[model samples]
Target: MMRVKPSAFVMLAYLIFLLLPIYWLLMMSLKTNTEITSTFTLWPADLTFRNYQTILTDPSWYMGYVNSLIYVGLNTLISITVALPAAYAFSRYRFMGDKHLFFWLLTNRMAPPAVFALPFFQFYSAFGLIDTHIAVALAHCLFNVPLAVWILEGFMRGVPKEIDETAYIDGYSWPRFFVKIFMPLIASGIGVAAFFCFMFSWVELLLARTLTTTDAKPIAAIMTRTVSASGMDWGVLAAAGILTIIPGALVIYFVRNYIAKGFALGRV
Candidate 1:
């Protein structure tokens, strides 16, 4: 028999430590309440699909996921759109207090979501925009825009200034150059920025829960419904947790290469 390396054992232990919770959640999702509460098996003794069935068939459960996707998508689009020009300006130009302005923008991202939650609620309430997808999307932009700008600026700065001059000399209009020539050069950066924006908006519960009532309630808020007169719906909650991980997993899968490039600071 071959001897196992200590490092391999450590790596295996680390993986188990990381994956144990997820595995437990999956097991719980497959078990009924009785099996879950009474038994402590590594795998489900009596597997059931009722929990997943309930979530898929119920509008309230399904709609929470829809609402989350809507706001997260909207927030990602708005953040990337607003950050592009702002990042370009910061990367290529200098003006009065430009550094200060950039720092101030990042300060907005540093601030806790709770600090702005009440103010956001009041502002949206005044405009009658509460409980809408746009409201949550806009609220998330407060943080996402700054983060997107900071990230995109780093990648933009990695690009040479000669490209802009060359494009301008070729009689390329500003919009034409930015969209056609410049954007593609920093495509990986954009992917990284969009990924962060989507993740922040997707996982952020405070602003999403605080801003919406029923109409635009996100899955994060709806997950609280597991507790009731009948006690906690552990099976359904676990199933929902599994479903929640899928979208983010899919996103990371598609952008894995771009994300790798981003880690290398946009190098070829």
Candidate 2:
């Protein structure tokens, strides 16, 4: 008989620990609220997909997901577009207060979203941007841009300045060189940055909740509908949660390679 290694046991246990909650949520989603609240079973006695059906059929429920995706995509696009040039400058040039400015940008990322909640609410209200997808996307930029810059700058610094010189020597204009030559070199970094931006904008509830009302409410916000005067809808809530996990999970799967490269080469 072969002996199992101690590290194998440890890894198995760690994976189980990480997977337990997701397993429980899946089981709960398949169960009725009565079964959930009254039973102690590890698995559902009668599996049903009514919870998922409801969310899929309900316009209000499904639209929340649509709203979330819209803002998240917008935020990722804006953050990457803004960060690329800023990061390139940081990696390629040195100006007075450059270091100070870089640190200051990071300070913005470090600050809690709650700290800017009221200010953002007030600012957008003045501009009549409340309950709009663009409002939430722009608000998330306050955090995501700095983070994108930080990560992109790390990857940019790893690139040789000789590349830029060679491109210029080949008669490539600044825009052409950046778009055609420079960006491909840092594609992994962009993927990493966009992944982080998407994740942050997707999962963040506080600012997202505060900044939007019905017109642009996120899936996370819509998840709150599980609570009612009758009590919580555990089954529906669990199903919604599982569905919400799908997008982020898919994104990670697609960008897994780039993210691994980011860990090795960039700030990630």
Candidate 3:
């Protein structure tokens, strides 16, 4: 018999810790309200699709999904567009105040969302962008861009400078080089960065809830509305929560290969 490595055991333990909450959520989503509240059952006593049906049939719930998808998509696009150039510059150039600028960019990620919530609301209201998809997208960008830059910068650093020099020597313009040659090399990095951006913006509630009202509010905001004067609809909420994970799960699965490669390159 082969002995198990300590590192493998540690990783297995950590994986379980990370997935425990998600496991609970999935189990709850599958259970009936009576089964959930009457007693603690390790598994669902009665498995039903009623909760999922409620979400799909309700306009309010479906709209929240639409709103969340639009805003997160916009946020990811904007983050990647800006971060690509900034990351390339940071990785390739050594200019005045470069390190300071890099740290300054990262500082945005460190800022508490609560602190900026009010200001964001007021600013968007003044611009007549309140309760709109763009407002949420832009608000998310404050953090997403910084994160994208940081992640992409690490991946960009791993890429050999010789490639850029070689492209230039071959008479390739900067834009052509980046689009055709360099972009493909760091494709895995871009995938990872975009995945993180989408995941964070999708799950974040405070800013998304504050920035949008009824019409364009995200699923996260809709989840908050589950608690009301009548009572908390745990079943609907659980179902909505489960549905919310689908898009992210599909995205991660599609990019799983790239994600593994990107992290293996020491860019995580």
| Winning model by TM-score | 2
Sort by TM-score, top down from the best: 2, 1, 3
Model 1 scores a C-alpha lDDT of 0.93
Error of 1 at 187 (Å): 0.8
Writing each residue's lDDT as its tens digit, candidate 1 over 69-122 gives: 999999999999999999999999998999999999999999999899899999
lDDT of 2 by residue, 185-243 (tens): 98889899999999999999899999999999999999988899999999999999999
lDDT of 2: 0.93
List ranges where model 3 is wrong by over 4 Å.
1-18, 258-268
* lDDT tens digits, residue span 82-170, model 3: 99999999999999999999899889999999999999999999999999999999999989998999889889999999999999999
What lDDT would each prediction earn against the true structure?
0.93, 0.93, 0.89
- Model 2, residue 110: distance off in Å is 1.3
Query: Candidate 2 at 24: error in angstroms?
Result: 0.5
Scanning candidate 3 in windows of ten residues, the lowest lDDT window is 259-268
Candidate 2 residue pairs in backbone clash: none
